[model samples]
Target: MLILTHTLHLNRPSGKVPIEIRLYQPLPTGASWICNFEIDWPEVRLARHGVGEDALQALVIALQVIGAQIYTSPYHEDGSLRAYDREDGYGFPVPSNLRDLLIGVDKMSF
Candidate 1:
């Protein structure tokens, strides 16, 4: 089942590229939940999973992982980004500003 779908408009020197991020329902694995996600890029697609304590946590972790990938990847002169198929251990850290842009502010309060 699909949980959430978000579109991010990445600005490049050439123009803006719309990237679609989709989060799917997490499945239980032992004591953790594994969330599956897909990032639809211009010419390539990325499919990965994240493990967390619960469904929401799993989805958040998946997004964080994807954000890290985007932050670490090299950009072309035109400002277009590249994504690798394999994972890089302890990838580059995502800045707060980028995180806010990607995940947005949490409006919910206790």
Candidate 2:
């Protein structure tokens, strides 16, 4: 099942590109909760997996991994154009954004 889906608008010289991220739950036969994720780029689609104890944990790991990929990518540099996370209503500040998303989780019993 698809757990989460978000679109990020990345700035390009020619125009803005829409990058979609989709996260899915682990398969029944999997040993652990494998968070499968896909990044739909303009020209290509990338897939990867993250292992966690639960669905929420898996999702967090997947997002952090993808965020690092974006931070080091050539698409982001010192430019007027910036990438925006439409769902979160914020720019690509990487770990900060990820941290903000997990604000309340830190205090949770889990």
Candidate 3:
């Protein structure tokens, strides 16, 4: 099992909110990599899972959900939720800075 830990900083209006993350990858031969992710915040304790060959992919998926929660949390500065228009006609709110942590790791192919 591959265990990874990270602390994410979300630049909120109030201040920089720190979130703790723990990711586990159990890569068994002949099977896809399954990742278990956990997030910790002052008022939120969340867990999620994803299956993918690359850890970054799983992290990305998990972050999407976590980001949504943070964006909509009462602690968020914007009283109203923010939305974005996509070319596919789907809309999504601005993601949290947790997603930004993957930028450097995303470029390298494992």
Candidate 4:
């Protein structure tokens, strides 16, 4: 159970504020996600502000895309909301299954 963490920073060419996204897999969720399949993907996205169902669905989609065992987190009230950073910027632990979505997962200093 390696904790693969990454970050999401979606930027708009129009200069609009970028939408931060955080997505991970191997979630501790006891749902049927485990019996799905093996995930080789490496990128994830979160709701950040009000992505709503899209964000949540995106998580499940990402996981199901490759097939990962969702790890449940007692501290994770709403994993999607974790994308946006209230103080500075949004931050989320990158998941190996969704790391491909990240612009620069390896360059991430944090």
What lDDT would each prediction earn against the true structure?
0.61, 0.58, 0.50, 0.32
* Tens-digit lDDT string for candidate 4 (13-110): 45323332233443333333321122221243322211113435545455333211222321122233122344322233344654443332222622
Better of 1 and 4 by TM-score: 1
lDDT of 3 by residue, 1-110 (tens): 44766665554568666767676764433555556777776676887776666656655655455555545565444332222122110122224453332222231311
Q: Please give the lDDT score for candidate 3.
A: 0.50
Ranking by TM-score: 2, 1, 3, 4
Give the CA lDDT, 0 to 100, for residue 81 in model 4: 19
lDDT at 28, model 1: 91
Against the true structure, candidate 1 reaches a TM-score of 0.58
Which candidate achieves the best lDDT against the true structure?
Answer: 1
Model 1 spans with C-alpha error above 4 angstroms: 10-15, 75-110
Q: Could you tell which candidate, 3 or 4, scores higher by TM-score?
A: 3
Model 2 RMSD vs true structure: 6.1
Q: Give the TM-score of candidate 2.
A: 0.62
lDDT of 2: 0.58
Which regions of candidate 4 deviate over 4 angstroms?
1-14, 34-60, 63-110
